[model samples]
Structures are given as C-alpha cells and as structure tokens.
Target: MGLLSNRQRSNLIKSYLYILPAFLFLLIFTYYPIFYAIFISFFRWSTDYPQKVFAGVQNYVEILKGDLFWKVAWNTLLYSVSTIFISMALGLFLAVQINKKVRASGVFKVALFYPMMIPLAAAALIWLWIYIPTYGLLDHLLSGLGLPTLPWLNSTETALWCIVAVGVWKHVGYYMILFLAGLYNVPSELLDAATVEGAGGFHRFWRITFPLLSSYTFFVFIINIVDSLQSIDLVYIMTQGRPADATNLMVYYIYQQAFRYWNMGVGSTLTSMLTIFLLICVAVIFSTIGRRIYYEV
Candidate 1:
C-alpha cells in the first residue's frame, strides 16, 4: 500500500472502472440466471403450487427416473456424436481439397461458406421443405431414380437422423473455414522438407500436416460438441420433438419443461444436469485429447 504513488493508483482505478461494465453484464445476464436456476431446482414451483415448496433433490430424482428424459438423453447423444464426427470429417476433407489451390478456389470457398450465412431457423425451414413427402425435393429425386421414398421427418427411425443431417449441413461450412485457417498456419517449411525426403502426399499429411493441426482439431471438437449439445433452433422449427420424441434434445427438453409445461423446478434441474454434463465433457477432453495438442513456439 505504501509503495503505490497517486498516479499509479489513478491508472489502476481507471482500469478497474473500464472492466466493471463487462463484469456487471456477465453477472446480471449469465451468472445470476445460472445460480438462480440451480437454486430453483431445489424447490417445487409450478402452476399447481400456490407457493414455492422446498423439495430437495426430488426434482432431480423424478427427472432421472422418467423414461422420456432417458429417451431425450439418448436422442441428444446420437445427435451430438453424429453431427460432431461427420461435420469435422467433411469439413477437414473439404478444407484440405480447397487448400490445394484448386481451380476457382475463391468461388468454391464462397459456395462452401454460403450455408453459414443463413440463420439456423431459416436453414431448418428450408430443409423442412426439402423433406416434405412426395412433393419434396428429396422424394422427387428418389422417385426419379425408381427408388422408394422414406418419410424423412415423420418416421421415428429417421426423424432424428434427418435433423442430424440438417445440423451437419448447416455447420460443416463453419468448421471448414476454421480448418482452412489452421491449414494456412501449418509451416510450409516442414512440408517442403518432407517432400525433399521423398515423402508422398499421404505420408506428408499423416506425419506432418495432421499432427500440426491437432490444436485446431481439438478446438473444433470442443466447439462442435457444445454446439451439437445446445442446438435447438432446428428441432424447434422443423420437428418440435415430434415422431415420438425421437428428435427431442437436452436443451429443447429443458425449454419445454421451463416454458411450455410450466414446470420450472424440473426445468431448472434439467438445466443444472446439462451444465454438469457439459463440464464433465470439457474436463475429460482437456484431460485426455487436449494433452496432445502441439503448440508452435
């Protein structure tokens, strides 16, 4: 305290003042809501109840014991895994092809990223039209080839996969762009040295390019996993969790409990569970895969 001069103290106070707005914004909008929801999960507050009643972990227990919740959890898992892996693979493949300076690369890049320019709700609506039976684009194409058309969005067996396809189509472009950026960051010198050593394309990519891209790959996985888990706009616009709740996801289920059904306690409990699940996912990734990411000096 005695070492700080008046001028230094003024500068320090100004720095704190500058950051105070952002801190207050996060506290009010983000942290407060999260804590409030967790607190609400410990109580019973619904339309049937005249007043809030402390219920302890009964809400959590009831939710866990419900078959619908388990079904929804399964749907969410399938959606997340399918979208993450497929999107990453396609994105990386497209990025690698485009990075080779293919003819009209600029045009191809624009076309690839075009989907990302559309909002998720709009994309869902567009795919909904394409999935409509008989008159839909997909059905028409299948019929033209003398193949039977399956109900894309109306069948329980295919509805979740249909939504998963839409998710992959929507976000693969964004992932491609990120991977493209990472590709540019890979050192050209290393690739050239590998080529001088008689390394073929496969060996060079497997031994050099891919290993160097581990950090970007890890980053994309984290982002895609979170996105797949929380994604609800498409399900909201297209399926609304129809076809026997086959497309119902964790976030959408929480929204249903909190808003549509007016079961705030259960909703909050679901939200807390989702938060914990996300934390565990991130922790596990950091502990395992994240340890191997290579950093450039």
Candidate 2:
C-alpha cells in the first residue's frame, strides 16, 4: 500500500491524541503501581526500618509461615465462594421473575437495585444497625416472632457470613440487570418455536433460555468472583477483621499489614500474591469455561 497522505496522517495523529490521556492514566495509575508493589516486595521496609533493606523473598516466607495468613486465606476463600454462588443465584432468579409481565415491575427493579445506589460504606453502617444484637431490626423481628436473637457481627461464627450476605445484597441487583439484558437478547423465534412444540415453561427456559444465557452467566460468574476476592469495605467498616479474625480477608490483611502495622514489604508481597492468584483464576476460567460459552450468530 502507498504511504498515507497528509490528511490521513493528520487524522491518525488526532486519533492517537484522543486516546493519549486514557493511555497515560492506565500506565501511571494501574501499571506503575503494580510494578512498584512487585519491586517493594523484595525489601524489609517498615516503620521500624526506614531504609529499604533488601530481604529477597523473606517477606513472602514470613507470611507463608504464619498461621494468621492461612486463616485469612481460608476466610477469603469462604467469603468468595459463598458470595459468588448466592449473588449469582439470587440475581438470576430475580431477573427471571421480573422478566415476566408483572405489574409495576419497574418499581420492584428500583427497590432491589436501590442498595447498589447507596455507597457501600453507608450500606455497611445500615447493616451494622440491623445486626446490633437484640436492639436491631433483625433481632427485633425475630424476637417478635418468638425466635432467638444472636449477635451477628460480634461473633466469630457469624461475622464473615454476615459480610457475605452484605456482598450478595449489594451486588445482586447489578447482576440481575446483566441477566435481564441477556434474557432480552435470547431469540424470540426460538422460544416461539419451542412453545409451538408444546415445550413447557420450565423446559423452554432450561433448554433454550439457559443455554443462550451461557455467555452472560460466565461473565457474571467471573465478575462475582473478582468482586468477592477484592471486597474489603464491609470488613473494614464493620469488623476490622475482628472477632478473632473471622472476617479477615486477603485485601484487609494487606491493608492491616501495610497501614496498621506499617509492614510495607509484607503488604507488597501479599499484594503480589493476590494479583497472581487472580490472574491464574481468570486464565483457568477462560481456558476451561470460556471455551464452552454459547453465542448467537
């Protein structure tokens, strides 16, 4: 091909210029911090040690040797698994229910999605009140019904689960919207033919609708896992990884190490570990489940 004319060259430069700001943002804010954290992971940098004394994987070894790290890892896994399944299930259910010809469906949608509109910290505070032992709304309702009242967030057995509930509540509506969009995109012709063939509602949904929604389901599943893994706001505001560290997660552990304890090396090591784990998860998911997703051509 011939070289570009002056107008074409000018247009190409303008296009690059249009994208320059966003490129710089990603380079500085995203990529730079990742590399910086990796670089910091090698050193013994803390409040006690102002100078960066190279520790060379000693931080990683320290974290791996600690019992608290394993406890936090298990907690993170439990929270992620519970939140991912519950949120996706509830979201799919709500989307299907609201997709029907129900009256005032839009109002129901808004009511469910309202939690997402609220800031997460504000939502945590709301749940905090709701979980306040016998004086909270939840306990009050249980007591009115002659049921037992238990401390939700102040107990080790229930604290992490309570946070998982919050995670599900906060993000389920967003997932519902995604599933709803997918439902809309399912080919009407296929459903009509299935109906004409005497396929029951459940059968139609199982055979046609669900299969067509595979791509959306996969996307939502990946998003839920990532969100669960990264979530720390509720843990920070409500529990602070307390009640014997029952609600402690990887991200909060990193925060505690870096800020509360001023252990920069350990914090960076934890950050790198989390990032690597997330990458592996995405890679495994894409290689396995992603290949099986159904697409409408």
Candidate 3:
C-alpha cells in the first residue's frame, strides 16, 4: 500500500510539472497583460511621466468626448456586421457546393482555401496593387470592357466596402471549411426523409441542413465578428485608414493612439472598452443564440 501510494504521488507530481509551463505562459502573457491594461486605464502615464498617476475616469471621459471615437465605433459595427453576413452566406454556399461529390472537388477545395494560407500582409499588398486607381488590373479590365474605372480604395464612399471585400475574400474559405465539416457530419437519413416528403432543395436546406448546422453557423458568426473587430493588418497595409479616416477601425485606431500618438493612458482605456464590448458580445451570443444552436449526436 505504501509503494502504491508513493507511485501515485510521483505520477501526480509529474502531471503538474508538465502543466506548469503552460499555466505560467498563460499567466504571464494573457492574464498579466489584461490586468496591466486595466490598471493602466485608470492612470495618466507617458514616457515623459513614467510613473502612473491615477486620473480616475478622465481617460474614459476623454475617449467618450472624442468625435473619432464614435466614428470608429460606427465603422467597426458596419465592418463587423457586413463581414459576418457576407462571409457566412458565401461560406454556406461554398460548403454546400463542395459537399456535393462533384468532379474535381479536391482541386476546388484547395483553390478556395489558398487565400487563407497566404500571410495577411502579403494578401493586402496584392489587393493594394489590384485596387490602384489608374494603373491597376481592375482599371485596365474595366477600360477594356468599356466600364468606368473605380476608385476602390481612394474614395470615402467605396473604401470601407473595398476593405470588406478583401476581408471576405480572405476569410470565406476558412468558414467554408467549418461549414463543410458540419455538413459532412449531418445524417443523410434526415436529408433523405425530407426529400421523400417532397420537400424541395431550398426547403430541405432551410428546414433540415440549416438547423443541423446551427452550431457551426453560430461559431462562425462569433469568430468572424471578433476577427472583423480586430481587423488591422489588411487595412493598415492597404488603406491605412485613408480618405479622411474613412476606413479607420477600432484596432487600427487603438494602435495609432497607443503607438503613434504615445497616449498610453487613453489607449489603455480604449483597450479596456474593446475588451468589455467583446465580452458582452460573446456573452450575448452564447446566452441567446447559443441556446438555439443544435448539436447532433
């Protein structure tokens, strides 16, 4: 009995030792940074004044008063909603198509997924060339077809949509894969039963496949919204929030405030606000929509 207890204790110690690194990593990188940001949000700190001086809600007040704050917030909302809707629609379409045992399905899958493998910076750079007003490929093609050249990234009217297009182009494949996995797991018996009842393709999809894929759809919605809110790399590289900050997103604005203007206090406050907003969104999604998502055995 003593020998067995000693062996069990040894195994327990080894298990904890294996998990210690990961626990420490999360603490140092994730929780530590979050707590630090929260603490700094209440202060007025800068390189000039390295010591943090508590300013209560002044940082938050400054953010609320800024005109750019509301503008960026609206821009983020527009970007997030548009991206989620479009991406989910396109992803579902592609998932349904590819799920059909069609010829060259493997090749189609690879081609669709190729964009996701490329780095965001590289993708943005490529899109920047494509969106160039005068000498871009799009312009030349439009001119050949007798259509007017568009100022895709130059005009305030089209800049946000242009970014959304690029985001969709990059992300649709990822969500398509998720939807495809869900589709594959759906029981064919349910589909066949629906078909036998004389349900047409659209009706069957709406009633059966959609309900069964609810969990995946919900997951994709949450992930896409989060990605849209945090979107910066493509916008930074392509538009730089150009045309009078028309394309300015929350994260990009946060980066500018924290790094460009060196307003750490305000930046921290913005970060806290973003974190809170994201948490609220997640909470709402899980509490309300999550209950509706179906999980098949």
Candidate 4:
C-alpha cells in the first residue's frame, strides 16, 4: 500500500513537470503582458514618470478624439479588405491551375510558394526598389515601353494600393497551399456527376468545386483579415507610413504611439481597441458567414 501511494505521487509529480515549461512560457509571454497592458491602459504610464497616475478613461477618450487614430483605423480596414479579397481570388485561381495534372506541376507549385518563404522585410525592400521613381526595374521597363512611369510609393493616392499589391504578391502563395489542400480533397465523383448532368466547365465549378471549397475559403478569409490588420513590417520597411500617412495601419500607428512617442497610456488603449475590434469581427463572421463553410469528414 505504501509503495503504491508513493508511485502514484511520483506519477503526478512527473505529469506536472512535463507541463511546467509550457505553463511558464504562457505566464511570462501571454498572460503577464495581457494583464500588464490592461493595467497600464487606465493610467498615464511612461518611462519618464517614476509613478504612474490613474487617468481613468482619459486615454481612451483622447485616442477616440485623435484624427490620426481614425485615419489609421480607416487605412487598416481598407488594407485588410483589399488584401484579403485579392489574395483569396489569386490564391484560388493559382490553386485550381496548379491542381491540374499539368506538365511540371511540382515545379510550378514550388515556384508559386517561393514568395511566401521570403522574409517580409527583405520582400518589402525588394519591392521598394521596384517602385522607385527612376532607375528602378519597373519604372525603367515602363519608360522603355514608351509608357509614362507613375509614382508608386511617392503619391498618397497610389501608396496604399501599391503596398496592398506587394502584400498580395507576398502572401498569395501561402494561401494557395491552403486552397490546393482543399481542392485535392474534393471528391472526383462530384465532378463526374456534374459532367454527366451536362454541366459546362464554369457551371460545374460554380455548382460543385466552389461549394466544396467553402471551408477553405472561409479559413483563408479569416487568416487574411487578421494578417492584414496586423501588418506592419512591410509597410514600415517600404513606406514608413509616408506620403501623408497613406499606409499608416493600426498596428503601425500603435507601435509609433507606444514606443516612439512614449505614449504608453494611449498605446494600451489602442491595443485594447484593436483587440475588441478583432473579437467583434471574428464573432460576426462566425455567427453569419461561417455557417456557409462546409466541413468534410
């Protein structure tokens, strides 16, 4: 009896030991920071101040009244919608094209996924060079073709769209893999049935392929939106929110306010706002659009 009790205790100890590292990591990295941010959000906290004074909801009120906050929010929404739609469409198209039993399909898949492997900073730098007004590859090619070179990053009107285009180019390959996985799992019998019913190519795709890929589409949409909303590295490296802050995304603005400006209280408020917005968006999507996602056993 004594030996059995000792063994049971030892097993329990070992089980907890196994989970200790993960628990420690979560406590330090996730929970701690989350609570810390929440605590700081209600106060006028700063490195310069030895003691933080409680400001109640002043930070929130101030941020709400700030024009820059609204501007960044609008920019973030525009970027998210444009990037998500364009990436999903391009990814689905590429997935379908590559799913075919074509010559060099494996090579094509590798080539398509290559962009996703590149680091965001490196990719942005490369795009910046391509978008340069003079002596850049794109501008040079356009000039050679007798077409006028348009300002890309230099113009407020074009800067946001240009950044979105780069984002699509960089991320389309990653989402293509998601779409390809979904396409592969689609039953061949479905296509055959559609064909037997005299469904044309477009008709079969619309009636069959798309409906079956609904889950994949929905997943890609969520991921793309989240990623687009959180995007900062590429925009920071390429444009630095220049040309009248055309590309000033929410995350970027938050980083600037919090770290650069040392406006910790405002930064915390913005972070909370972003978190709430994301939660609300996710909830709405799941409650409404997510019902259309078809899960295959």
Candidate 5:
C-alpha cells in the first residue's frame, strides 16, 4: 500500500541511468529528424523561408499527377525486386556450397565475405571502370571470345541493369555469411533422423534444412528490401539516373528534389511516401512469414 522500498527505487534509478544516454541519442539523431520531415512535408517550407505556408497534401497530389513519378516508381520497384531476389538466391547457393565442409573453407568464406568490407562508393567506382564500353574489362573478355560488345553504362536499357548487377555482386557475400551461419545452426539431430529415414539430399533440404532457416531468410528479406529502397550511392556514382531517367529511383529522386532542385516540400513528401511504402512492405513480410519462425529453444 506504500511507495516503493528504498532498494527498489535505487534499482529503478540505476536502470534509467543506464538507458538514458541511448534514449536521448535516438531522440536527437533518429526520432527528431523523422518528425521534422513530416512537419515540413505539410507546409511550403523552403531554404528561403523563415516562415512557411501550409500546403496540405498538394505535394502528394502533384507527384501523383506527374508521369515521371510513375516511371521512376516502376524503375525503383523493378530494381528492388530483381536485385533482392537474385542476390538472396546467389547467396544461398554460395553458402550451401561452402557449408559442405569442403577443402579450404576458411579461404572460401573470407573470399565471399570480403566484398562487404569494401565501401559502397568504392565498389561503385570499381564497377564503373569495369563497365566502360570498348576498352573495359567486360568487353575485353567478350572480344577474346569473338563476341560483339554492347554498351553497358552508356545505354539506358543496360545502365540500370549494370548497376543492379553490381549491387548483387556487392551484397551477395554478406548474405552468404548470414546463410552460412544459419546452415551451421541447423540441428544435426534432425538431419541425422532425416538421413536414417532414407531421405535423399534434396528431400532433407526441402523438408528440414530450408524450413529451419526461415528466420535467416526473413532477416535477409527485410535487409534487402531496405537496401533496395535506400540504394542511391551506386546509382549516383555509376549512372546518376541518366540516359533519359532510366535508372531513376525513389530515394535518389528525393535527393535530387531536395538538394539539387531545392524543393524541400516535395522532397519531404517523397520521403514520407517512401517511408509509408516501406512500412507497408514490412507489414506484408511479417504477415507472410511471421508465424512460421521456429525458435531453437
């Protein structure tokens, strides 16, 4: 019936003290900017503004009316879907190969995981050099085989895809390591039981191993979705959304609107839209995969 005892109060105070710095950090660096973005999105806030005019949903309406918006939206969707699915599959294949306890697995793991250690801009630059048309590495190889060479980053049809391939290359290693860890944790007893039941390799994988990696797959899915949505550095460095906006993506579109064009209101609206879209995607992912996760405990 009374207030907390002295020891309980002291413990509570200590817990609060331990968490206070992290909570404050998130408030300043993460939460505040999101709220501020939403605030400015509703108004005609510009670099010249000391005071702003309220615009409601006009920015959203205008963006919806534009043909370019939909073009860029389709571009973004295509790139994201293609990059994530292909990269994840490649990663899974590599992980399974390496997990076979083959000779020199340590070396193989390092080779596969090394790409993630490189910065994205640096990787993009390297791919840029590789993608140059006639004198580049790709064309050089094609020439060796007596095959005709095609424009890579120079053509609209291939520029976006070239960048997407670079993305898959850069991220596949990281996802491979994640899948490798999942494979390592797959219960030995379950595999043994499946083996004793005369289950072949494909059957064991489909019935046992793959389902056990559901959590890892879910994590990879979310990470790839976010990566795909926020991906701009590669596109910026490689193609700059050029060749008639063939590579235009939503995040880079927001960047161009906000910084290059100095249209803060529209930029903020685009930001809000991207946020909403990603949230919906996350919800859908959870709905599809949430209850299927099997904890090892």
Candidate 6:
C-alpha cells in the first residue's frame, strides 16, 4: 500500500540520492581495493591477473623471512614513536601557551600552522637543502660554532632522526590545533574553583586540564601512529630508503615491492599485514589507554 504522498516520497528519495555518490565513491575506491589486495595476497601476482600463480601463504612467509621486511618494520615503529611523542609534546606546549590571552596570539598561531600547509614533497626539498653538507643551514651553524658538522640525511645513525624531526615539525601544528580546541573545552568553572583553592598553574593543568584533554591526546596519538606508518612521500623524496635503509618505512617498502620491483603478491601480502596491524593496534589502544579517557563532563 502506498501510504506516503508524492512530496514526502520525493524528499526521501532526494536524501538518499545525496548520499549515494559518496557511498559509491568509497565503495569503489577504498573498500574494493582493500578487499582485492587481501584476495591477491594468497597468489604470486606479477602485476597481471588471470595468469597469477596461486601460492597460499607463501608470499607472507617470504616477506616475513626476508631481512628487509623486519628492518623496515623496526624503522617504521621507530619513526612513528619518535615523531608522535615529540610532536605531541611540542603541540601541547604550544597549545597551552597560545590559549592564554595575548596580543600576538593570532600571529603565533598562523606562523606555527603555516608549515602544515606546505606540501610534503615541497617541504622535503626545502629540508634537503637545509640538510645539504657544509653550506647547508645546520652544518653552517655547526661550522660557525667550531663544532663537528655531522651528516644530516647521509649517515645511517642520523638519517632516520632527521626525517623524524621533519615529521615532528610538519605535524606539530595540526596536533596543536586539536589540543587548543580541547583546551577551550576544559570547564572554566573548574579552573576558577581550582584557582580559589590556591592551586597554582602547574597544579591546575596537571590535575584538571590534562585529564580533560585525554580524548584529544588519544586521538592525536592514534593519528600520528597511523600517519607515520603510511609515511612514504618524504622518504621517497628525501632519502629513498637510502643510507642503508635507515629511513625505510613499511608503506614505502610496500610501494617498492608493488611498483618498483613488481612483486605484486608480496606487495599485496604486505598491504594485508599492514591493515591487520593497524586494526590490532587500534583495538589494543581502545582496550587499554582508551579506557582511561573521560569524554563526558
């Protein structure tokens, strides 16, 4: 039985039509590729289909057995952990400082946020020049101070750290914005009450503000980890996993396996592994640290 009038049915259809394009776009581009990658992981694909040789779990075995896989896995974790902690520390510091009422606060915000707007490739190029031997900014300063000018991006020991610094610098601003928003949400009454109790700045921040900001901190932590895991552009542009693969990350390694070396099956296996790894990480985070966060007043 047709119960609804023509106008009501038309509005309902239009609402569904509005969301249909976005639904289809994600289905085709994101979901399909993910599922297909998992499907191909069990085969020996060489960038061609139908002729792909079936090799169940062998690609996973090969990638895990290879020394390169473990090396990049460690590098990925190192980069992610280093960048996330440093960036969050800097971001939280900046957010707290900037949240105070000051004359030049707007200018400081803009200056800090500017770096995040720069394209990663472009930023890598600029940093490449800065890290250039002898005449570069860093080495020039070191030389001027009569200190040893170490290789920035050339040495294995420092190459990953250099990239980590770049990542921290680029990402700290975005995280600062997130923390700033959370800071604003901290209850003014609570702070005022703490103030009346003769609570000092550090006491108030540690006891009240930081606890309220746990949600934002958790979000920034997860995002930084995920982004670092998928970091490829800067590595591709700056290091290309050079200096003995010190800066090699998992995503770049996957790209190399799939495109450069044309090991499609191995690439697919890596892709699946990365997905599962991220899922497990997220689950563990929610089960552990996420339980401590308070979202409600």
Q: Candidate 6 residues 210-275, lDDT tens each?
A: 999999999999998889889998899999999898989999999998999888898999999999
**Per-residue alpha-carbon lDDT of model 2 for 1-297, expressed as tens digits?**
159998999999999999999999999998899889999999999998999999998998999999999999999999999999999999999999999968999998998898999998899999999999999999999999999998999899998999999889999999999999999998889999999999999999999999899999999999888888998899999999999999999999999999999999999999999998999999999999999999762
Which is the leading candidate under TM-score? 1
| Worst lDDT 10-window in candidate 6 | 45-54
lDDT of each: 0.92, 0.93, 0.91, 0.89, 0.89, 0.93
Of 4 and 6, the candidate ahead on TM-score is 6
For residues 1-297, write the lDDT of model 5, one tens digit per residue: 149998999999999999999999999997888778888788876676646889888888998999989989999999999999999999999998999999999999898888889988888888888888988999989988999998898898888899789889889999999999999999899999999999999999888988899889889989999999899988788777887899989888999989988889889988988887888989987887877777671
Deviation from native of the Cα of residue 89 in model 3, angstroms: 0.8
Q: Write the per-residue lDDT of candidate 1 for residues 41-73, one digit (tens) a residue.
A: 999988986488999999999998999999999
Evaluation by lDDT, superior candidate among 3 and 5 = 3
State the lDDT of candidate 4 residue by residue for 23-117, as single tens digits.
99999997788778878899987776547899999999988898988898899989999999999999999999998888999998999899999
What is the TM-score (0 to 1) of candidate 6?
0.92
Candidate 6 deviant stretches above 4 angstroms: 1-18, 47-50
The candidate 2 region of ten consecutive residues with least summed lDDT is 1-10
- lDDT comparing candidate 3 with the true structure: 0.91
lDDT of 2: 0.93
Mark the regions of model 2 whose C-alpha exceeds 4 Å error after superposition: 1-12
Q: CA shift at 54, candidate 3, in angstroms?
A: 1.4
lDDT of 3 by residue, 1-297 (tens): 466688798998899999999999999998898889989999998776578889999999989998999999999899989999999999999999999899999998999999999998999989999999978988879988998999989999999999999999999999999999999988999899989999999998999899989988988988887899999987788877888889999999989989988889988999999998999989998999898778763
Question: Candidate 5 has what TM-score?
Answer: 0.94
For model 3, the stretches where C-alpha displacement exceeds 4 angstroms are 1-18, 47-50
Per model, how many backbone clashes are there? 0, 0, 0, 0, 0, 0
lDDT, candidate 6, at 291: 95
